[model samples]
Target: MVELRRDPVVERWITIPRERAASIEGLFPGKQEVSRGACPFCPTAMHEREIYSIKDDQGRWSVLVVPDLRPILEMEGTLERRAKGIYDGMSGVGAHEIVIETREHNQSWATMAADQLGLVLRAYRDRSSQLRGDKRFRAIFMAKNYGGMASRFSHPHSHVLALPIVPRTLVEEVQGSEDYFQYKERCVWCDVKEQELAKSERTVALTDRFLVHTPYASRYPFELNVMPFRHVADFASSTDEEIADLGGCLRTTFEIVKNRLHDPSYSMIIHSVPLRNASEHSYHWHIEIRPQLTSLAGFEWGTGFFTNPIPPEVAAQHLRG
Candidate 1:
């Protein structure tokens, strides 16, 4: 077996090419939105603020949760449907909550300690359970968009979306995972872990409880998968210990990357079981982290194939070193 640091097959592989990167427009130039970003998410003094906040014993605010100012899916109060020329679209009716992870404007996930990240993860699970029970809600997804282009706000935060429809990505994952589960009579993600380990080509980082690898066919560049080696299926179902450990893994990975690579911006999203009719063992929970260093253009969107510049193995070696 090749050493963990320098696996030949893994190195010099195409992670996403330069032209491919250039192909994705509006990817670079780094999110020209929200000039001079400030602390607009701070807790207010009115019930009309529609924001909830947690504070430390010193009365200093720790975290803030508020409805998104520019909501993609704000509550319409009721669902009324109409049609356009040849397409059908509903009113943007969903909950978009901005989770202000910390008060520090400059600090981000990479700089956050494991304990701090754990608290944020707990907030996600807590909100997921609360939102999933809503009759109008169908799914709750936790996502973070870093850098200027990815989000309007620059602080370390994530969004908990309570969507009425199961997202297309969730639908696809269900179909793909379920098919593999039935055929192999085992969790496909578990099998994936084994395969990635055996291949050892994309492994980024491993800890006592977690393993981070680049997907064999990564949809995006610098895509890192953080999975619980024990095959936990739901992010909401994780224990406190697991959350803490996962947070540790997150912190370590980000710290290493920040130290090794100059890249500071990225996006992270969790792939967990759906809110309704979920087969616990049929799926596995994981997080995908992709740095905001590439763009997606027509060829990628048209052809449905993403080109990454830096190979996973090389990225991993650099990260591990």
Candidate 2:
């Protein structure tokens, strides 16, 4: 049966196609061969200066944070808002940093040690907290693009962007959340966690502090959402214990995907509160993992809707097994 699902926190619809024709190999292509070239992310071949790093027992860097080699936005400029004929724009003033996830170039979240992943997650928290100090930045985005086609480089790294304005998608999400809170008087994500837990149909796994589940309106096959049980608005404020548990939770989730889908290319995004403002009561921080199983056809772009061959319930069942 074909189904159309609307996202709870966003006014977006996802259509589940009638035919489940995408096979495992079709969804996850074969692993690409790596080049034996000079990787700048490697410690010995590094060209950029480090902003922050965590050391291992041997005094070697475990996780490193460096400025993006080619930044999308400039870091030194102040926000300059401008208006043209019936249009508005701003200067490209923002901070873009690379969180070099692991010292080892070949390691990934699925393969890396749990403690090492914790260090990586901690680096994200530290960098976000540091960037929040800059009054010029209104929002911070944290994400990881993994596998050959998804990432620019083969190195295990993620990105952090501190923007002068909140992104449109995030703005909509916060607004939707606030509207829900105004009516229901509770956080939407908290309610989702509770409902998903109660149903267990879309839940893949659960830790003491986090829930790993496929959203009811998942846009892609094997899409995953990892949310903390605690209603925290900013990921930067995550406690040590919470981060540690989250590390294990993420590691297990990615490993499951890796094993089930043959290490597909995927993008992972962390959604949190804007830097300048607060949404503690209405919003909650969460992580979204979208495996690049299928490309967006013209229909999706033209209609602003996504088509998924696998229903989230079926995807969750496959993932759980």
Candidate 3:
């Protein structure tokens, strides 16, 4: 049976249609293609002309930074601003770098050791801190698109972009979170976590410091977000201990996804306060992990809405098992 939903953000009524799931009893259970032929991300292949790689004291290829061959915004372009009638355009000025996690072709986050993931997380923190020093960089965001939908490469890596303007999604979240905080005199997200935990519904996996859950009204099947348990405003300011705890959470999240979801393609992002707007009280740092289980149809973009077939309550139950 179809169900009606009330969205807090859109402040409107929505419908969730019912559908049957495909049976995967003997589906394509393929293993990860690790250490295959011609993996440039391998440590031995770091000498590629375009790669910026560094070695650790122990002599491992610990870090890598590369220019995206096809970047959304170009770095060498002039900042020419123009307007055509009601439309406006500006110079495409931004920096996009690919941070390769490891030299091993197959060592993804879930398969990596806790210490290794911690190092990758630290590298992200360090890179973000370094980019914030430049005044030209107004906003910085990092994203990992798994597989083709999430990325164009099979290597385990993420993209970091320093943009001239805040992203549209981030802008909406900042405004919404801030306004809700002011009116409620508390963080609405924090309130949400407390209620979710108390009710114990729509929660898939959890740790001492972080949790993974399907929101009350999900737009996609098996879509989830993993957020910190404590309150923090900036990702760069996280304590060393907090980073370790977060490493554990990251490991578990990927493990559960890989084992249960059958290695589905997903995109993960670390959302934090923008550099110029660092001290905003309304914004709280969080990480969102969304799996690409379904394609977006015309109805979604045209109406700016979606109808998730699997309810959050059911999705959580599936993941928990």
Candidate ranking under TM-score, highest first, comes to 2, 1, 3
Model 2 lDDT per residue over 24-82, tens place: 55445454444557887888875468899998889988888989866766687666665
TM-score (C-alpha) between model 2 and the true structure:
0.88
TM-score of each: 0.82, 0.88, 0.82
Regions of candidate 3 where Cα sits further than 4 Å from its true position:
1-37, 46-57, 76-80
Q: How do these models rank on lDDT, best leading?
A: 2, 3, 1
Candidate lDDT values, in order:
0.72, 0.85, 0.73
> Which candidate wins on TM-score?
2
Q: What clash count goes with each model? A: 10, 0, 1
Model 3 lDDT tens row, 48-93: 5444555688876776777775566556655554455644445556
Candidate 3 — what's its lDDT? Answer: 0.73
Preferred candidate (lDDT higher): 2 or 3? 2
RMSD per prediction, one decimal? 10.4, 9.2, 10.0
lDDT of 2 at 300: 91
- Following a full C-alpha superposition, what root-mean-square deviation does model 3 have from the true structure? 10.0
Candidate 1 has an lDDT of: 0.72
